[model samples]
Target: KLRERLKISGDYHECNETNSSLLLLTENNTSLDLNISRDAVFGNCLDLAVKKFQKRHGLVVDGVVGGGTQRALNMTIEEKIDKVQLNIDRIKWLPREKNERYVIVNVPEFMLHYVEDGEIKQQLAVIVGDRKHPTPIFSENISYIVLNPYWKVPEGIVRREVIPAMVKNPNYLKKQGLEAHQTWDENSPRVDTSWIYWEEYLYGQKKFPYRLMQPPGPKNALGKIKFKFPNKFSVYLHDTPTKHLFKKRVRAFSHGCVRLSQPTDFLKTISTFNPKINMKKATKRLKGKRKQFIKVKNQLRIHLVYLTVGINKEGQVEFRNDIYNYDKYQKRRIR
Candidate 1:
């Protein structure tokens, strides 16, 4: 009956039985109450309930029943049931027992939670990978943190993007702070970009043996700091040069790495738990313009999760968009 009542949609400013019953039924059914009357009128009470519902579900907190609100409200009981069950299966796949410390990033929600002993330490907004380059769901330990990190250009990126861009514009490398090296080694001699045959590799006439790297600087893609974890995906939780991207609501705008909004604060948070991290030395390195890596004495476990539905701190069932369509991958139960 609740699902049938929620079937009504569209922009509802004034009150009718359609909108009134929908809002009242919603408040009664969910963990929300506006003290709204059952009378058929779109009053302030019902409006507050609508916004509250939006906030709980991570939707834009607009009182009007817009496209997004309508879609979420229109979700059938059966569909919501399936979503909850699918996420339950996902939770079961997680670590059976809680650990001393761990961080979990729910990809769908675009938020990271630093949890220790069942308490949340810090929460931060994150920009994850886009559709084409979706952030892989996996678990790993943060091995170390790098200060003034060099943005090492991946081989695939070198061949596909860098080479083509270089071909189009001759001064692209110099302008971008990119240095061509003889090999992938710290002490390797720098190769003159002018000397290398750019066309041969770009045209697939020959394999590019050399490597390209962006040294530690303002032009660096990894910004000033990075949380390094040795993983097969070569992905890291790092600071981004494009800080303005964080201001946006939906923040899926990266190649594959997770971009942290507050890297310095995150560093401080990490230091609080890990005694071995030298805060003074790290501060000095960050101020200086040189690359340095500090090993993590106590490696913190991290899980990149894809959950579309879960209970929030308020104990209300919160819903997130199936950003990666991972929810569809879960097999639905037959009635």
Candidate 2:
């Protein structure tokens, strides 16, 4: 009875002729048939499973899977079931309904999706936060978009990354297209740069001597497009100039911001559901210096989820890696 429950039929041959080394499962003197290649099972299978899982979870449907998918699949069956239950509990985390059109960013899968009229219209690769700085899970309406916008260096980035680099090379800021403005104290009064050497600041004996900002261009980290929404976390979705990163199967290489590979496709998809704005007009508006905020007619649902094990459209149970270690955590958390 236990063997039957685990699908341990003697006739099962868990090997594929195309790839002889691939193994799906072996139990009760029987081998389980595999749906994907053997190499795919351990590596790409988890990646593909993650993509399928992400699609079902209302995320981008890209075929390449990464850390988020690995972490999700590494979860035990009990943990996965718990995640489904948690999703049910947090269903209210999303808006009751959206403007008939909207965009969703799934941090785990590092992808974004555009949906309209209950159908996925476009999908794009995205760069999400690393384990140290996991992307926040939230949802909000996209009020507008900014093209060629200047980057306002975040305070956290300045203290942790930029300031240290500046200390080593005062010219580092200039090379990265950053310009230094006067530094201010609590009184908002300007502090002279000559009084304090910028290089000594790295030793922890000095303060950040100036405000820095990177101008808009190809070298700008924010890329060419930025999607804006109303949120307290100061998080937003945007494009990245580093297009090469998308080629990786497991892309988890970003600060807190979400980076999309195909912003144009996403823009077009969002405009379709937004009756108030047409794609042509939106494109024209983006080209100009003036920014535009086109409200969507229907808000699209967005979900950032992690699923380690799942059934594909073909109804095969798939496995994946545990990238974020979410599976381990979920197992401990779930009773």
Candidate 3:
């Protein structure tokens, strides 16, 4: 009955390389007249259309009508209506008061919007957190910017990741330009790697005394800059070395911190709020090898929200997958 109302005609056929070749041809930028065929055999035109639909819907662009794609294609009008209503309720929970300017990161959409006077001033793609390391939804103020930033490896990552890697290869720290410190203090003494027992650290027999830090450089994981905000979660927005990940439709790669696609441009936009922020000097600082923290004159409100369905500027109902399963939880509550 739902499928009949939605007019979902047929199940997506098993994709083949022949159909994928047609998909490649469509991407060639030359127009090819491939007639729409009946047999539900994924043809060049249909495959290309499916890919475009997937791209627009923020799904993985594999050109294959798999489970995820099939589910999206099969969504009934009633389902979309329910999602729209639920998102409306979610919006009501947010503060009704408007700020003069602010930053909003919609997690499911994988995008950030900088707004002023209720108008969008700037927008960019962002990589949010995955399920295992979910990005928290909350409001905070972006207080400062760190140029040529060093990455203070998170304690959880250090325990779960760094120690294991070091156990396999002791040179991992040196090769990655990372250093271990006895304490998180600015002037903490550096720990000599040779004296450390990797197994003791990994096995929890010995406490890892040092905090792992990567010095600011081309290979730095935090890229050239970081936007600081006060949050109990210790999560902040920053640039990343993995810029290629931003091109993907579903960008939930970060542990918790939001990774900006265009950090430089984002910096410039926020810099305008405070007269003290000098973009000239800031850009110059980005060239330096040392990490420098620059406090902005005015703090901008930044909200990390999980809105899977929204009404865009054109007033079209845009939907995205519930990357964090917030929609599923909300649906259960509705029931």
Across 2-90, the per-residue lDDT of candidate 2 in tens digits comes to 22332333332222222222232212112123255444554555345545565554334553333342244344566555655654554
**TM-score: model 2 vs. ground truth:** 0.67
List the candidates' TM-scores in order.
0.85, 0.67, 0.84
**Prediction 2 global C-alpha lDDT:** 0.59
What C-alpha lDDT, on a 0 to 100 scale, does residue 75 get in candidate 2? 44
Clashing pairs in 3: none
Candidate 2 ranges with C-alpha deviation above 4 Å: 1-99, 182-196, 203-209, 275-312, 315-322
Question: Looking at model 2, how many pairs of residues clash?
Answer: 17
| Candidate 3 wrong stretches, greater than 4 Å | 1-52, 60-67
What is the TM-score ranking, best to worst? Answer: 1, 3, 2
Query: Which RMSD values do the candidates have, in order?
Result: 4.1, 7.7, 6.0
Give the Cα lDDT of each candidate.
0.80, 0.59, 0.79
35 Cα displacement, candidate 3 (Å): 17
Model 1, span 1-335: residue lDDT tens = 34445545533443333444455454453434355656523456666777887877778786755567667766776888888988898899987546778889888889999988888889999999999889999999998999998788988888888888988998999999999888888569998889876888885567888888888878889999999889999999998889999887688998889999999988888888788787888888888778888888888889999998988777878888887877776653333
Model 3 agreement with the true structure over 247-332: per-residue lDDT tens digits = 78889998988999999999999877788888998888888887788897688999898887876666656679988778888899
